[model samples]
Target: MGSLCFNDGVQDDRQPWWKAATFYQVYPASFKDSNDDGWGDLPGLISKVDYLHGLGVDCIWVSPIFESPQKDMGYDVSDYQKIYAPYGTIEDVDALIQTCHERGMKLILDLVVNHTSAEHEWFQESRSSRTNPKRDWYIWKPPRYDAGGNRQPPTNWRGYFAGSTWTWDEHTQEYYLHLYASEQPDLNWENAETREAIYEETMRFWLRRGVDGFRIDTVNKYSKRTEYIDAAVTDKNSPYQAAPEMWCNGPRIHEFIREINQVLAPFSAVSVGELSNTPDPKQVLPYVSTRARELDMVFEFSVIRLGNGDLFTGKYIYKPFTLSQLKALTEKWQCFIEGTDSWATVFCENHDNGRAVSRFGDTSTPELWRASARTIALWQATLTGTLFLYQGQELGMTNMPASWDISHYQDVEAVNFFAEAVASRNEQRIQATKHGLSILARDHARLPFRWNEDDNVGFTTDSAKSWMRIPREKGISVESQLGDRTSVLEFYREMLRLRKRFQGVFVFGTHTLLDRENESTWAYIKEGFLTTKDGHRMRGRALVVMNFTVERAPLVDVSAALGCAPESTRLMVTTACGAVRGAKDELSAWEGRIYCDFGPEICI
Candidate 1:
């Protein structure tokens, strides 16, 4: 509701659109099939830009597009300079980047620098013989000679996909390490030559092509175990374990990030790392410091781990957080990042997780979709950072059909988690792990982007087969709702409009978290978007309340509460329950609403 201004200090001028960007992620293989092939590719993605642009997303983050073995669904990059044949080539990538830029949109690639495919030329060469020049490019150790003169693995550390993290290479007579699948061997980041080469190639490849930014995968693990540490000794005789700390954010981590940042700085390219530790502001600041290191922001994993109270308990987690936990986690991160050089990468879902609509709140009802979405966006954009939107999110995509059962799951994480559970012989944990795997797997988020409720959900061929199944109907689709003013697609458009309109608040605003919540309310405030030093000319202040319930909660009237300008106390907007004929109303079972007024103060 407050008056806004760009850095020019004139309330009359507007800020650049990117200051309030909304990013949407695309998992290419399962998104759309252009030539009627079984897998989705870049050309198919080109056809969908209109849909994304129509939804008002400013940036599109496509999952790993580099040439790969598909062991981790393109994450196991074999060639940073080349493109995956199935996804298309360098020209297709160039066209995709150009198309997005022409529409005033930005593109961020999923950077998987933590490891490389064993099939890559470097790995192939490294494994050929112990004396190979590239032998030190990856982690490797001699096999432990047994009493019988047979060879044994150097350690029992298990690979995430199935067995040991180390696979013996008979040709080289050494064991090569892989944190994920055996095909994705971990790179020896400690090696100056190896790390430098990767940084040089990866940076030079995209920056030269005019791409916007990167979403670093397993971002914290760039620096890894020189000791090749052993597993944590869990039950089921589990052998795979590397306290990522032993590797994550290691001694040379900052050095590598600084180097990458050097190459990216000239391009104004943004980088956001997927972080999974405690949100200690000091620890997180350098990576995003304008003056320091790697990324522009960090996407903390606490939100995704919300429902899982105790991961080590081996529990089956299939629930969502209450309005309380949601508000708290968001508030904590908001506070920390605002005070530090770091910015936050806001999110509820991404390529490796399930959709937020189904997970955060009930979307079975239409009203819920609008309310929850608006509530989510209000909180996200108002934070001191950028935001990410996984594909189909604008249309309010939910989790994949639960009816498919375990046999249908094809994601490596899902398959591996299932196997890991089975190997433990803990039936209860097995049940829990399987269900948890479904929610946590890439497959859940990889469902075809439903352009309409067409056969294959407008993704794969009717006669041809998709590597994965498409989502079932929920009345939520792009085609049916594209032109409808009362649809979720349009809701997103309005959200982006509002965010861009208040760019300063959504970008550099100082955040203050509301302390409490009932089942109905999630509240917070953004204060410094317009300040005296910035030549403040705002009509009033901004306080936002995202009510996740239908029952109206008690309010803290700004006129009577914080004692600011009364004129600004007038309601700026309602995410739902508005007055006009087409105005949206009461959220679905778990839908939400954002109410804004005066030099505002929210009633937590």
Candidate 2:
């Protein structure tokens, strides 16, 4: 496909754009508590710049810092131009921007454009008088009529949080839409003014402030399935769709994204959509593609590796992907974006995702967290794109309070789903099954970072309790693990160093897969490294292999296809620190192996 593959072969001249960049994601609320108020503020984050740089990251991706009423932990933004009072002030944000740029690093804010807080001035005016100039800024309609004039939501489609997508306003006697929570009203992108206001002002506000990029929350939700046609009522207890094809990749999605991209082009800003429900490869392709108007990259949730269990349907499910299943998810996306400037942002855990350490392997102990984290880090980082590391992920922090009962829980979605299932389905006591909904709800994963064994896991400063309870420890603590080179944190530190060293291969390499039949392992190779910012003067090969099973799972011969004989390749890094590094046809369990085809007994 032209010299875009470049000379050295690792990076594409088609897009030498992303070589040597690494992104670290921060959940501002739990990153650091600079103030003693028990809340994590911007100043708290400022204190950790050195720590981030020390990890050798090229960029930092911070979660929402906008002004919000916080019904959804700052996701429901009240003011696009304002920072949440709890996060810190405008001065604190400026300090962060200046600090990051000075360190030669870029900062990307989490942009919540799918909707705004109900308290936003736009929504306030929309709800005031039906004839207000901004009334059309948000979707509003007359309530659905049953037998009497008594009203119901306009549609059967449920909000992500639960219940009807429409909310009633007393002042105008009309219904307003909320795809997520009632407090976060959906913006009517169909309105040119609304789109322009959000695009121009939001970009200018941050771009002028020196922010580098953004992680657009629910990127596909902007246009809605827009005919506003009634969603077929299926799954009586299910308020939403098992899959909403019409809603996710809507008609005007590309048009809206292009409008935003034009604003971002001059600044070289990186914008990745937090794409959800993109079950089809073709539908998922355009958003991250380089072919036309789309984003620089899109974050994929393949690593979440969710279980198939239908707790709501009374079916117990377990999820362990076959070798081809994972290869399909990771490689399909990789191949789709190969020719485009649009790229994929690779990650495992984030603020809303469950802890990868626990989800991938046993969370029974902190050491296991380390093993799982190391294995996962080693694998995803080897892919062809930018890297994303979530907060506390390096420490291998796990899912919150494993024993958390219904009384201690606070996730809105978790609670609402349980109530919905009970009220609508009459399922066998769903309230009692609130524990089941916790398995998939966003809250199960978004707890505070655990820094110390001391009060509040050192997440908060004052006597106040943390936003979410920290998971109990069985030998995991940053203070305790910092000095241990063999700890998970150190492993992550080294992994970053290694990937940085091989930036050309991991970031710019031509992507291809080896074996597809192996059920319990993940395998791939990055070949033909190209010249990057640094001169690449030689030929080389890099292979990534991960043992998905905790038990030993043999890998198919990937070296044979890449021109490496079994005897010629050398085994490099191992997830298990103390284990002897070797080149057996099969890998030991949960261990990841990176190989180089230098020669027999290849030199390190």
Candidate 3:
């Protein structure tokens, strides 16, 4: 195969190991439970290493496993070095890492350095006295007093969890900043000592434990320009809303990331920043740019933003996104990041969003469920980046049952949003509001893993309860899908194997969208040129076509588009439904196919 450098002249066909890897995100709490404690532990995760190995995952990204007060579900880290007791001890983490290595899989832990639990020893000392050495470790400012001596928050900024970004502390007579929950105080990255301590305690410590890397949470929020400025108000009713522009990708963000990168370079570790606040890929490029020496990649969220709605109403009250929109978004990122040292982290589902099938595809019936699952999975794997598959994704999991009420929700973000929406009744009508909240809740993804069809769906013993209610979806368990030849799990295995077989084309090839303007049909071409075993140059191409709707969509006539007859395209991977034959053939709802062909038959 011919080797080519990206347009930027820095990235070539030769990429890092992570660039060709497939990742599985395990939300530890809901992954699996051992010891009947109603919570998932490291031991539970260690036992599943084989399961992951069989799933063809190159890496497992375990969500935050640090010590905390359980507020914000472990994002609020009290101790950077200790594992949360419910999860297990440090030795368990070591064992898990070693086990993953033995299984030929890498482990990447969640790094929540943007904020620390208020109960952290440093925060405790900082609040104890104004003169404390650790006082500057957290963002602290004096309250703004009115003429009548009434105190207001230091800044008119709301946190991600709602309410003020600053919390008043009577002992220190000041307010500390928290971009997220008040219990999770933002760390002062401006302080050299604070940054150094984080390196030694979190990054270095974990690297020494033999962990591969980290998924840095809220990484773009690490640096904030020094100012007590009030953010522009789009909604007068919520004037103090958290200002992402002022804090996200702040002036020193790249510098700090480079510093962290330098420390990680020696260990040969990789990091993907959770650039949650960055809505534009342009804003994210620098952080992952090879020239910047920062993160290896960053999570771009344009696709997820499609399902979201008004800030107050959340993602539930939204219009359906079209295939054109998905195509445009993916191509936009692919075009921008193709040649640069920067890479993309592509995923359609995670612990924070509703299940992909429920949110992006029709799941009202069994056939639609599988088709929808396969379509999204095929599209994700064919993209030009690292692929992250959330647990149960391969099993074609749907969202929480529509009948579940507020009591069944477990994620703090969803639960708090429900209460806040109800309390702020004037914002919208009550009944319609509750319906939307239930559909958009994050708990839909946090439910326990469905292992089999049993009393607890095989998540736990009959006598043992789960930390959160486990919603039962018949035939969606691993046990049910394991041996089924046409099941979603098998489909995923085939997709992965095919990807591995055509790694050069899928991972390093040039990506081109063929039907950017078509709403019902999304098609793309991935092609690469490589040297054959006998030293002859060969070109391989994979044409991916999908029907994003339930109704049959007319097959796109690629004869004119690609200058190749439809009969010449060989079916590679597809849904259980057979491939289309003629130029005007139609596809079943959610049906898709990847056709393998040789040469420059398809235009790049």
Rank by lDDT (best first):
3, 2, 1
Point to the candidate with the largest lDDT.
3
Clash pairs (backbone) in predicted model 3: 1-530, 1-531, 2-529, 2-530
Most accurate candidate by TM-score: 3
Specify the poorest-scoring 10-residue window by lDDT in model 3: 1-10
Candidate 1 lDDT for residue 349:
80
Off by over 4 Å in 1: 1-19, 144-152, 156-159, 231-237, 309-320, 364-370, 461-464, 530-536, 550-552, 555-562, 565-567, 577-591, 598-604
Candidate 3 lDDT over 171-258, as tens digits, reads 8789999887889898999999999999999999999889999998888888897987888775576647647777888989888999
- How many pairs of residues collide in each model? 12, 15, 4
lDDT of candidates 1 onward, in order: 0.69, 0.71, 0.79
Whole-model alpha-carbon lDDT for candidate 1: 0.69
C-alpha lDDT (0 to 100) for residue 200 of candidate 2: 76
